[model samples]
Target: MRANLKTANLKSGDLPGDVTHHPYDAYGLPLMVEPASPALAKDPLAVQSWFAEHHRTLEALLPTYGGVVLRGFAIPDTMAFNAMIQCYDTDPNGYAGGLTPRKNIAGKVFEASRVPADQKIILHQEMGYLPSFPKMVAFYCLKPSETGGCTTIGDMRRFQKQIPANLLDAVHERGVLYRRNYRAPGPVSDPLVALFRREWTDVLQVETVEQAEEACRAVGCEAVWEDDGSLSMRYRSSGFVNHSVTGEEVWFAQVQGMHFNQARLAQNYDTLNKAFPGGRPRPIEILFGDGGDIPEDMVTPLYDILDRLAVNLPYEHGDFMLLDNIYTAHGRQPFTGSRDVQVGLVF
Candidate 1:
């Protein structure tokens, strides 16, 4: 802890900080919670004390760091609640490869897990891919890898700070390319194009340039088509996306488009799924920093900026990390070993 500095108060103790503010730099910092005593952890009253004290503390601390991790915090519920255990279990196409299939606890809630599962998980706030993203996210590990599954975070707001202004201006003005290849869309309806459509020349159902333009129009934006039959677009649109409680404008990309890294997004994403049997999706690849198609000039600086703000901490048998949606972006650190965890995506 940075002695004498302030903290965000959550339900229980102090959390961390916000590295930057213009709505794009993430708002909270990550806290590697100082571990409490083992014997006291077993005391029910003591357990209650830990949970109860952290929230308020973290809230005050949220303004300082990008997110926080309650290290060594045990998840007593090896088997989550029945409602949790049954749902969102199976989404054949919704998530990337290697996630356990489970049912939703409710219409839009998370279910629980049975076996101890361990594998490094990638990041993207719950569902922030296009537009329908989550506002806050957290995870509690009932069991951690004897070896891997560390968490990596990217503060998009901070990420944008590193994104050259010229690129930002281009996105705001010239727009970017965006290609989404989904054979089957999630139950959540698409705001722009109908998920079901005819098989085009490729013998596959895809959102064509025309359809993408129509979808863009629906969202009050314009779309253009490249000669190669790809879609290009931009958004000057705005809405009341203030955090449900804060009403503050979220620090996010102006809109979704190819401007960010179209070739790269398409490159990293293996839509054909030609290799995996069940046709597994690849891990989430969102680079405000550099990985795939980021331009040469932007690579070194962007990575440095991101590396400064983002933090990646491996999971433990009993650890919990809470993320403030407005401030941070997170991902997986490639690793090898048993890494099992159960999730509770609370609003």
Candidate 2:
């Protein structure tokens, strides 16, 4: 017989079954699960098989909770995590034209993000700027830092409702446009600029501009070559998208995270403005679909909403989290010691 699972809003305590469910917070933002049986917790294969057996229930849970965390599992490393993800989703997404730098670890798993440990990556949906993106994303914590380094998450549905009605009306009317700049590998005068940006060849996994343009076009983006050996790719998408399961229009853009006023780069805003041409052409730009500036008023309140709703989901060794990409947004908090979180996505 399958191990039964029950949901509740209670403090940490033992359940009578093989699995226990707990809410991380008041909003029940991420439903947390752990093995209640010693045998289930000791055997990795049993945990994996349990996940496979309850895949449908888990799928149903995600639409309501947005995210699910399976902690205290016996999975050993990145390879085991990849195998477990394969049990749920066979088709893994390729990270082409991805913003953050990552290294492929196992079959479909990759380093969560190579952003420096000191910087906070603000909450944003995975591949939100792209036309086609992952439908679901999963993270496996091979190791946790000694301090901090929580995987921050926010409910997009809440974020959407928080936005002022006027701003939502404007976004619905104008849509959102995103632009990304890519430069070729070369000696950069500023080390800071190099640290934030990546080369076009590396991002597209192609050697020539022609190949890069082709790749960009395939993904519904328009690529333009700059006079200064740089590439600009533009895409237009709705600021809000309907949640696949809930049918609720959820906030689903990268504007807040890509903006210069982002948590990590806000302090260097002026200096970064001076680093690039036009005084404000950061690596990425978010604008109205018609190439107009998104009003400052609209952008400012969003950060506040995200900050108010942000919940840091602390990591532990062998903890696995699955998120519905359309319903949730995720980020990274600053850390002290080493942290290894491998991630995988399915389109």
Candidate 3:
């Protein structure tokens, strides 16, 4: 089968068998790959083999490109996508103790975050707050939205360079602390409980508070059981991480989503204010490692930098994107109509 692979602005190279590389854009935001022969679509084994041959190439290019989009291969369903990802990551990681509420669609394949379509999710690296996280994240688009829905990506390396020097120094020196409170599951009719996608039970995946605390401790989070059956979890980590491959320090925290005054949380805060007129503390908050509030002055410019550098990737059915989670952060845009994106994480 003829396989045409393109790296951004790089010339085609001779490879074993029928595979060929083609030059694309200079930025390499998403180097696209496609099969030259249509017959390859029907042979899953051949497709898998072809991708396996180029696995090292993809890994080497991922840090430089930030991401890669494979198109026109006719990845029929989640099962097919799962097989494809296995070529790169033999054992993809499962979503356990994950913050987002997602259903497992197949082995290691999960439905993307279950947030309201109208709400924009702030750009964040997957599981960035946790001590350990996936090295790569793959998204397979099953269906495309009618309008506005696009997976947004930002280069953390670029964000790191452009961010204010003082803020960078502060975060690097003091780190970031994330505070999350998971309330006990309430009746389905309760709007407040509905807003919190998962309860302490679901998040901890255990029946009793003791087990929950143990699970939290395993992940390096300090947990406390509240008087009202709520669970409070606190963890601290640096805002920047050295890219596993590039060794460049990248902005790696969830400050955009965790900070109270950021635009990303403005809608949630407005809803919360209307629900509780007296104003209640947010279910999640971010602070300095020493527990001081993050200054709005720091957050405002960070938000602006993310906005300026964000790349909105419009989805098409059967498209698959694999991202280097360390150097790239992903988010969702407000959308209308039906959209289905499945995700698989690689450790």
For model 2, residues 139-240, the per-residue Cα lDDT tens digits are 889889988899999888888888888778887898888988988777788886786667888887789878998989877789988777888888999887
Clashes of 3: 0
Better of 1 and 2 by TM-score: 2
lDDT of 1 by residue, 228-247 (tens): 34333323322114444434
Which model scores highest in lDDT?
2
- Candidate 3: worst 10 consecutive residues by lDDT? 1-10
**lDDT by residue for model 3 (1-347), tens:** 01113432222343334433432345557666666656555666676677677665666667667777777776877788888876544222245467777878887788999889988887889988778787888899999899977888888878878878878889988999987878876666667656753587887678887888888877778887677677878889987777666556778878877777736556566776454333333467778898888887888777888888788878888888888898888999999999999998887
| Every candidate's lDDT | 0.41, 0.78, 0.74
- TM-scores of the candidates are 0.53, 0.91, 0.87
Best by TM-score: 2
CA deviation > 4 Å runs, candidate 3: 1-26, 87-93, 188-190, 271-281
CA RMSD for every model? 10.8, 4.1, 4.4
